[model samples]
Target: MHKKQKGEAAVITLVIVMILVMVGGLFFGLPLWNRWRAGIGGEAELRQAEFNRQIATLEAKQELESAEYLNQAEVLRARGVAEANRIVADGLGGPDGYLRYLWIQGLSKGSTPQVIYIPTEAGLPVLEAGKR
Candidate 1:
């Protein structure tokens, strides 16, 4: 009877130690498992980036080509405008002469006949608003 009781006691002690080992392992291993999962996710993202690299490069190239074409078109337009201005300036004698020509043309066309009033020495118009 004594020997049987000793065997039973030994079995109970072994079971308790096994349970403690399993619990301790679970406590320490969870963080390591999560870290490994995150590493796998990062690797997947890297693979996706690698897959799209050629497409990204082609898109950038297309954008740069389009910008260059547009810039050239704008330069051509500006050159045309400048040439027209130069021709008009030469025909009119200068920019100031062109402006005076425009003023006279405006005066001739309008029916109401705009009045030109010279400013006095005080830099005010000839007629003040409240003066009789």
Candidate 2:
């Protein structure tokens, strides 16, 4: 029938228009998608910086706690050493107190001893010393 052919032509035109619209949308939407992808990169960088800041803060706290514990251990060590020295001094009475003398003697071992004289008073610089 002649009417049927005209209806088929209209349907063909409608299909063509729909395809053109879809192509236009594909072209126009490309830049929008690119912008969204660029924004995601910026958000990722911001999140990474926030995580780094948090990690640094936690590390600093840990370092401070470690330093505090180290100082406490050092204090305990010094106290123990002093107590042991006191006990040894009590056992030896006056003999254990000569450690300084022993250390000075150790420095002079297997070497000749030297003596030097020092002036008791400082003199003024010579103003008219003769020069050759």
Question: lDDT (0-100) at residue 59 of candidate 1?
Answer: 96
- Lowest lDDT sum, 10 consecutive residues, model 1, at 123-132
Worst 10 residues of 2 by lDDT: 112-121
Residue 98 Cα positional deviation in candidate 2, in Å, after optimal superposition: 8.5
TM-score to native of every candidate shown: 0.43, 0.63
- Where in model 2 is the C-alpha error above 4 Å? 95-132
**Over all chains combined, what TM-score does candidate 1 have?**
0.43
Residue 43, model 2: lDDT of 100
Residue 52 accuracy (lDDT) in model 2 = 100
Q: Tell me the deviation in Å of residue 107 in model 1.
A: 8.8
